[model samples]
Target: MTDKNPDKGFVALLGWSLNAIEAVDRFDRRYVVVAPPWAEDYCRQNDIPFVPWDFDRLNERSHELALTLEDMGVDVAIPIFEETVEWAGAVNAVLLKNPRLLGQAMLFRDKSLMKRRAQLGGIRVGVFEEAHDRGDVIRFLKRVNQTLLKLDGDPNDPIHFKAFDKSGTAGHRVIRTPEDVDNIPDEEFPALLESHLDGWEFAVEAWIKNGKIEFLNISEYVTLGYSVFVPATPELEAHRERITEEIEKLIEVFDIDFGFIHPEYFLTSDNKLYFGEVAYRPPGFNALELIERAYGFNGYQGLVLAFDPKTTQEELDAFFPKEVVDAKGHAGCFGVYPRRRVVSRLQVPEETANHPYFEFHELSDPREQKVAKRSAFGTHWGLAYFFGDNAHDLRDLLKRQEELDYYV
Candidate 1:
């Protein structure tokens, strides 16, 4: 796993992920993990290069860690989680001597600011507003439905509420009725509210280097927060060209010279694309792992290449495979949430286990008898993975898992 090439950039990964760590360890780049104190012992035992620092809010003292990594001769900082996105930007700004990068990272963390910036850049987005309290959310909901011209007896369209800073479906909710607003706690206020865009929702993982896309992959969602697969189906891949253009526009809008971006979008029935926010780090739901399964390359390694200032065009070109064409097969994963009100143990459905496409699962036994009340889009207990030559079959297999009980 040692690199013969000594000129490769030294990277500081600003978060702890075993998968990421393992991938980087085998790659050529010299890397160190900058994580919380909790990971100190694990890194020591595993022989991982380590630096312990809590990623609390950036303050005057934040410059100390930046200086620490700077002294270590680290060339770049890569954020592996949402909490560390700003930290990476802050450290990289100092390391790279670019002060504006910190402000740019702020745009990625705040949902309201991100949408406004996208809008200013002429990127289409659904109607959105910032809600400071329950009253603000209810007002936005009423206003959106009123704009849609719904009759008194007609069902109201749901408005989406999301935490301004959290990633994925964390702190996300669909407010379909006024009564639904009551469930939102006061602390969950100061959120972003948007009118739902009804269409095909998908995510794009784009690696950028020197202001150009080095690699891009579209992940089609079978069910948001439940399942996702890489090397999107042909019907979805047909929009590849347009999707690429949108990603390029995003790079221009964000002033992104280099890094990985995981952005969500909606392709409406009319064939237009609307932006649905972007993350400045690896995606959740084991997306990077699924991509590695579909394509024969490590996504974490690709990120290192993108973020490294010394990365050569030849290196970037050689690292990525030819998108869908080069993929050996389709790979997908289903997040398992127990369906039964009470469950005793974990059980993989016979049909699922016997399927030719079945790979493996990460589900475990129930820790408690009572299933906790799901809030918004709740977290899944574990993931079930699949792989196959057929995209349709993989999609169907992933969808079928939702009906089967994983815990019983």
Candidate 2:
């Protein structure tokens, strides 16, 4: 372990991410990993500073965590996953001596509350409501299309169904027909319902300190769950100034003081911007690794910087490189999901592997003879990474991979 500086803050990471632990392990801050009991043996074997605590839904004993970290001389708590965001808030409410921090964390966790809050704050968002049952979903689907002025025999406009607190695309579903609503599982109810906003949808990763955005990067999505590339295409990058303005509005509205937030947005064809929900933790699909590959900086370390109250402006200026001007090339990745329902092997398409932008992939052989039908935008089997100089070429390359079968 790298020796920690005595003068800086001691942080408690609220979940397990080897990438996060490794980053903190090499940095100057004293830290400990707090996760479930399952991680205890691994932490012991690897010499990772650890505190095994079950981070389930908050219970009567949640406050005990704050007192424990306080007794240990820990200065701050940082969340590393979706579920941990609430715990970090509950703990930081005590550590930072600000009770409102706990409530602020809830706004980030709950999607319906987040949209309502954003609406109250003057951030544009699509029409949304909470659904308690399948009946509610069907009504919402019909109501949204009605508001859109659909005529008889006109196809219904799609509405989105999402779990209130899940991470990106996990509980997300598109409902264009009543038949689609029937496919939803019962346990997924009491979710957020949103009217589909047409146009380009993308995500923005921002690091905030002292209630100001220090660094912002636009992540362009070729397809929502299938592929993403950083620094965006020139078409999307064209909205940087306005996007920055919107992010500034977000910081003010959310009352966020420090740490990283990955919030998505919708840019309409006419150039209007709308807020999608914001996540308090790191994004899925290895966004940090892609940023590191393109920008030559450790995002996890930058997370440490943003969360530490003692971070200096000079340090912030030095740690962050010029956004688009400093990137070496566009770094993109395709999430490979087997198209065929029955597949037995992993095959890399020759066209994909032969491209100069092709770097490496982590695909593996099938474990079973039958592949489960994808529910919504199901999880990818693994990711294929690529690097190149042109964003348009990278975008096209990522889109083309959707047609080729990776497993057969």
Candidate 3:
């Protein structure tokens, strides 16, 4: 329990979350937080030194984070979540200008910028357009002729729609045909429409350091009957290798010297690889921990070491398990609140409370109405994470929980 002195070394994690990274752990180098002030209590409880900043403006926020860290004598910064993307470039701009500060975070935000950079490096990426309004959506759809149109579309297209500002299953809707357009209001919603891939969805996890890409882990996602999570099988290995190779090329192209990325891919029946989307930060489903288990590398540790090139991979390995079992994989499922406009006090097997891999379980009551947001393609409420010896076992475990049944 040695103190992390700012003068010695410290890392800054932005967009704070309790479970994703060890931002507040005692063993971490002195930690400086660039998050809302409300998180100060959590920092104090964990003995982690922190510096709070506003999120109103990305540039200003970045500058402020740098100034705060410098005042505290911190030499390096590593962001833990994506919310910090808004200001990452500005912070890196500051660091790049000042000689000694380490680590860069610009490629993590702005999908259009990342993809353009990736393509230049020879990484095959799906055609994509950044749409900010209804007009943008229409224009992009017209250009692609295969709009995964999200707003004001016919309800019969079987297209799923979502807004840019929305996360964790919010701001999602489906447009089945032209008639469904009438159901949406005329107000603008920042959304993107892309051709949907009808195949297995996969998330490839990697850590890039000094332009070298290390494939950390891969997860096979079954989005058919449900979005189930499992370890990658042999059928997905080739696709994973190809994607990994392409991602490595992207790293060299982008000069992503030090960071983690979650690039999602789709493998069709013919094994044709299709890029889905990429997130510069860690995956959303607490999947980082799984990565740590599978690769025997502490993603958070590697993140910290990315700045200090001298830090050995051995040190990172010491922080993670040497081997992870496919049987130890986890399944994640989501269930919405009751579909009625009243209080939905449903009950379930209390055993769910003790499930080993139940990473998160909660009830969304934003409107105080028991009814959850209605949508065919978006998750409504109540998510469960459980591990099993295999994908089927995990799925069956979720089914048996019977905790997700709806009630008005």
Candidate number of the best lDDT? 1
Minimum summed lDDT over a 10-residue window in model 2 is located at 54-63
Query: Please, what are the lDDT tens digits per residue for candidate 3 over residues 1-408?
Result: 445544434666766766534534545466566777888888788765566666655454467676766676565556566666545545655544642222234444544565566666666666665555555554544444445443544432344445543333344555444444345444425454554456777777677666665445667665432344545554565465576666776566656666677776767777677665566666665566555444434556556665543456665545534223423444455343454567646544456656665555565444464554555344445555555445565555655644445443
lDDT of 2: 0.92
When superposed on Cα atoms, how far off is each prediction in RMSD? Answer: 1.0, 1.0, 5.0
Query: What TM-score does candidate 3 get on C-alpha atoms?
Result: 0.76
Model 3 spans > 4 angstroms off: 1-8, 20-28, 41-46, 96-107, 130-174, 179-190, 224-230, 290-299, 307-310, 320-343, 349-369, 375-382, 395-408
The deviation in Å at residue 253 for candidate 2 is 0.7
In model 2, which residue pairs have backbone atoms overlapping below 3 Å?
none
lDDT of model 1, residue 137 = 86
Backbone clashes in model 3 = 9
Of candidates 2 and 1, the better by lDDT: 1
Per-residue lDDT of model 2, residues 42-79, tens digit only? 99999988888998755556699999999998888999
Q: For every model shown, what is its TM-score relative to the native structure?
A: 0.98, 0.98, 0.76
lDDT for each candidate structure = 0.93, 0.92, 0.55
